[model samples]
Target: MMTDSADEKPTETVAERGMWGNFRRWLGRGEDDLQDRLFALDDAIAHHPSTAINYVLRGECYLQIGYNQLAERDFEQALELGRSALARSAWGFGAQVAQDRAVRGLRIARRR
Candidate 1:
């Protein structure tokens, strides 16, 4: 028989924790490596379309690489997928007015 304890914590596998490690490493890599990592993240996103966090992560990478348009797109998609406050803040919009402006910007971009 097995017993469960309230103080026991669930364990995360290396694969589950690798994203952050990879992200940290990517931050210090050159442009080419960053691009390669971004491509890999895109592939991961393709396989996991419903994961909002993946979109946000990819958006961060895009922003770092000076791809503002793509980053905005990903942030907008993340917001649509219910990312809400985090996504808005990540795009540098923490206040309600800023969030509204972001929404308008997204709408304008979509219309073009």
Candidate 2:
């Protein structure tokens, strides 16, 4: 059995690799960190086509940076993925949250 320690690096390195760096960039608070994270996320999704968290995060990033169309697509994708996830887990909340977000994104698009 493996035991976690304070100094131990997390196994999910991709998630820890400066995701906020991209968010900061979107806010004009940092350098162009999105391209690299987006590329990595794209590759990860290609490898694991059923992953939904990536879609939600990408959608949020797109919205934050004013890419409404792209954000809508991502939010839609996230909703679908959230649905699938919900189907697989009886106690899942991600589906509801994703659905709410998608609805909000659609509203934003309508206002534009």
Candidate 3:
């Protein structure tokens, strides 16, 4: 999640609620700008395919912008990566979060 205050300074400090806020701001912005952010996230995912945070963020963005197919793909990828991370660690919180995001994503995707 992220935020932009009255001064319009972007801040990446928000709980789950901020996800919607971020989505709204992105949606209201220009399409090219939003796509750039998406591409940046995509690049990050490509470099760190197993990162749960990156996957969740990208998937969430896609879902927000009505790209359910892409969202599903990101979510599924996140789930696989999360499971792998979970297996490789004794206590992996990020992996657990990613797994949960994937399940939620499936529910969101059901409408598509």
Candidate 4:
């Protein structure tokens, strides 16, 4: 048996590739397809609520779709789940619209 090494890339099975192959192709297609992928991601998040990256990714998708409220909510959740810098950046962007204190807090946080 071969030992796993740090420099070795993980090999993906054909089944695993097939599962997400369409999604990879659809990413560059159009907004509608992208939205479909986002919805699927949201469903995945529902099943795995503890995954912080999912919230961050879905927050970005919400921003792209002009769902500012949902984006803000997801970003806050991500922040609570330990994604401080990214969540602060998202909050700063949203603050441009609402002028929330999150922008100020983000600057203060970055100073330290």
Best by lDDT: 3
**Which has the higher lDDT value, candidate number 3 or candidate number 4?**
3
The stretch of ten residues in a row with the least summed lDDT in candidate 3 is: 11-20
RMSD of 2: 7.9
lDDT (tens digit, per residue) of candidate 1 on 1-66: 222566766643325646666456445557667776686667667766755555666766766666
Q: Per-residue lDDT tens digits of candidate 4, residues 1-112?
A: 2336877877543344453563464255467677776865666577657545556566666666667677677766665654444456745453333233333333333343
Candidate 2 residue-wise lDDT, 38-112, digit = tens: 665675566556767667666666766788888778777877887888899888776677667777775775466
User: For candidate 1, what is the lDDT?
Assistant: 0.60
Q: Which stretches of candidate 2 lie over 4 Å from their true place?
A: 1-31, 95-97
What is the descending lDDT order? 3, 2, 1, 4
User: If both were scored by TM-score, which would come out higher, candidate 1 or candidate 3?
Assistant: 3
Model 3 stretches astray by more than 4 angstroms: 1-33
For this target, which candidate reaches the highest TM-score against the unseen true structure? 3
lDDT of each: 0.60, 0.65, 0.72, 0.54
Q: What is the C-alpha RMSD of each candidate to the true structure, in Å?
A: 10.6, 7.9, 8.0, 12.7
- Those runs of model 1 whose alpha carbons end farther than 4 Å from true positions after fitting are 1-32, 83-112
Question: For model 1, what is the alpha-carbon lDDT of residue 7?
Answer: 70
Considering only N, C-alpha and C atoms within 3 Å, which residue pairs clash in candidate 1?
none
Residue-level lDDT of model 3, residues 12-90, one tens digit each, is 5324325455445434446567676686567566656667767777787787789999888888888888888999999
